[model samples]
Target: MSQATELEAPQAPRTRKQRQAAAIAEAASGHVGWMLLKIGLLAIVDAIALYAAFVLYTASEWVVLGVVVVVAILVNWIYFSRRHVPAKYLTPGVIFLILFQVFTLLYTGYIGFTNYGTGHNGSKDQAVASLMRSAQERVADSPTYGVTVVEKLGALGLLVTDPEDGDVWVGTDEQPLQKVQGAGMDGDRAVSVDGWTSLSFADVISRSDEVEKLSIPFSDDPNDGTIRTPDGRSGYRYVSTLEYDTAAGTMTDTKTGTVYRDTGVGAFTAENGEQLLPGWQITVGFDNFLRAVTDASIRGPLISVTIWTFVFALISVASTFFLGLLLALVFNNTRMRFRNGYRILLILPYAFPAFLSALVWAGMMNESFGFLNQVFFGGASIPWLTDPTLAKVSVLIVNLWLGFPYMFLVCMGALQGIPSDVNEAAEMDGANPWQIFRSIKLPLLLVTVAPLLISSFAFNFNNFNLIYMLTNGGPRFDDVSIPVGHTDILISMVYKVAFTGQTRDYGLASAFTILIFIVVAAISIISFRKTKALEELN
Candidate 1:
């Protein structure tokens, strides 16, 4: 009576738990939740893909459109079916890799071969439209119409009232003038329309440039002219002063009869060597790359910037690694009290964001009314960020402050992982602390740390944020045509060329980028080979 049966033994508890788990599983399997979740996610993915396809189709990107459509169909098939289980896991990453990495790289390389700059950024049709628009002038004898600037669906339009016939009409850049029946009018001026909102005087003033640029077509044909307004109240007809010969690909000035022919270099040029701008994009084989190396204005600055970049990366790595190793050695001792607390303090710089830390240091280093000038130097005005030499020094100092903690953490881990027996054996062999570190510990440390040091060098090589945020690559070079500075690296120089200048020379910048990529790849390969040699020492 006191003993339990064999069936009700210690295994009964686990059996009961198993039964409960099975019951829960059976109930969960009966629910439609898992199916609904899968369907919902698939629906979202399909919707996004369809939207992208529609945009690509409208843009007439046939090759990319075909690829997208095929990919979308494949994705839907893979996820919905039980087959190709591995494909379901790999599809998302592969698609993202193609779209973001492969597409971007290809597009950039294509741009490098072409004159894809500010004036030569569009297709031939767009260039023609722009040229024609630039040649437009108001007809002196054209009748003025009473107009009210109105907006429909965020597009500017003219709600125009005819003076002679008193007919109300509305037109935009795309739409030809059309009758607006039953429209509210203030004598001769159109006050309101049913579907559009009239812009207030303040709104018109705020959007002055947009209102001035708005050209409402008077008729279906472009030759019929468009009505433009300077004040958004009165409109007058204007016609282009240039006529394009579509059959022969020439633009003729209507008044002067000067013919501009397509030079096959993007611009339409006259025989006397004048060119009409807003040119179409055209490929120029190796011209951009040649310009970077051969052009006198760019070549000299490029050489100086390249040298500075190498020096900066090398010094930054050396300084940070040495300092970090020193601190790590000091704290790694077992006899040292409060080692953990000191380590936490040592890594405090790492805890804060690097960008924010750079900014704070920037303020402190400011020549005027800064923390260092006012407090430490007694308002000495040290010109930390202004002078060329001091600016480079300031960048290095800030980078070391921001960078050393990472090196400290890495070196600390490497030092701790070294075997205690190795250190003890070196001591028994009559080796001093320095001798042990130089011969045994160093070789061992290099085996683990060489790869990381190479990576740190790579990171410092392209360290754009420090150069940009701290100095903005300032103390500008007086002799250069491009915007580069004493502290400017290759990446920053490329940025200034592509974006800061009046002409946004994307092709030249891309060419420079290709050069930079080649340099970095070569360095990484050679350094990695050296790192492999260190690994053999262990």
Candidate 2:
């Protein structure tokens, strides 16, 4: 064929199958369904983020609002853009890590520097308002106005009407009284307003606590007094016995003329060193840390707990590892009879939940009418959990039982990983089994297991459940103000300080938590560095 005719010739008639395949490939490349699904999911996520941002803004949490906005923007940018494929994959995990781990650590650090415990948990303005509200008393011969309880958007307000002037007003705790344009009245009393729903007698009874605590101001002026409802039907004017001076920052008692000035330690204090409760949270810097070291109430118990913590962790690790290694070595033999049976039996303690096992042990070891005392010890009472010394020993024994099986599994794996030739060479030499284990086998085993040992130590250090369920950290210290005990570790002590009492000192607990993190990090770093020597054995 001529060159011009060959170039101009039609190739062929396309097959139906080929045309169908081409259409499928084009649809796959477009990814329209996938893109739509992705956009739908993104839209839902953006909606949630926007709602959370709005709530945070209303709460005046500016920093958190900023973070939410930034995260939402980043999420949209990464997923929608073609260039940020890696970021799209990483965004969820990074966001979760920041929200759960990084944010928690940062907030704990912030609490450690602030007076964020009970009675010190709000802003200065809130504290002032609370103080004023708490100091109110009904003025003698106070005028009682007919009132109706109404609710709007979950906020309760009072619809008050004057029987004398026929003037009506509505107010909530946050908003002062304002005249309403339209009202639904029952004679002289206002039963409802335009935007509010009147609550029934049953609803008022159900919300008795709220009704009793309701205090709506008469006007914007603090001196004008507040309208308080006693039984939802009648409102009385109540004025504060203590008047606050904004410029001088003092609260003066109108009756006694006692002045309370701002102490800057989160409370207003009198000249006699008495301070009011429910003060605002303030930055106390290192006061919480200093309280850990110097305060007489906590210092002695803290020192005792610190020493016991180190001792408990070290002893627990050593005992568990020793027993576990001994068992692993015995079962590592191929010629051993019923090896699988024995291995399963050894792992029985680990099969059941650790907390359940602890509870069982607690029951078994009880001093009165317990299994040990009644059945085994001929009715002689042994204070396994009651005596201070016995409690510590009991805790160790229980932990060893609970902890050894894990170490057994780990040691067994490590033992199998070690080459048999090394032990053979040691035996062929004059070295006996003990010498081989100590010199050759032990060092090699540690090359793999040292990191695990360090981790076990850290885990045991903060083993809260075992201590809490086993002893409840009892054999209580009689002299201390805090509810710490002889057997309490630092972590248990922190729990007691932070939550178990009438007064929960969260700031102090955060200080202790930071100290623990520091200690564990230090020990882990040092232990990891020491493990480098074991690596040289290879």
**Candidate 1: Cα lDDT at 208:** 96
Q: Model 2 segments beyond 4 Å from truth?
A: 1-37, 162-168, 184-186, 193-195, 219-223
Worst 10 residues of 2 by lDDT: 217-226
Model 1 agreement with the true structure over 1-538: per-residue lDDT tens digits: 3365765666635688898998778856875787688789989988988988888986789998898788879988998785898998999899899889998988889889999998999998778767877888999998889999999867889998888899999988767799989888888788899999999999999999999998876776555668899998998988888777777788888899999999798988899988898998999989999988899989988998999999999999999999999999999888999999999998999999887888898899999988999999988989999999999999999999988888899889999989999989989999999999999888888888888888898899889888888988888998778988888999999899999978788999899888888888899999998788787778
Q: Residues 380-473, candidate 2: write the lDDT tens digits.
A: 8999999999999999999999989999999999999988888888888879989988887888889988999999999999999999999999
TM-score of 2: 0.91
lDDT of 2 at 351: 94
Model 1 scores a C-alpha lDDT of: 0.88
lDDT of each: 0.88, 0.90
Give the Å error, residue 487, model 1: 0.8
RMSD for all candidates, in order, please: 7.1, 4.1
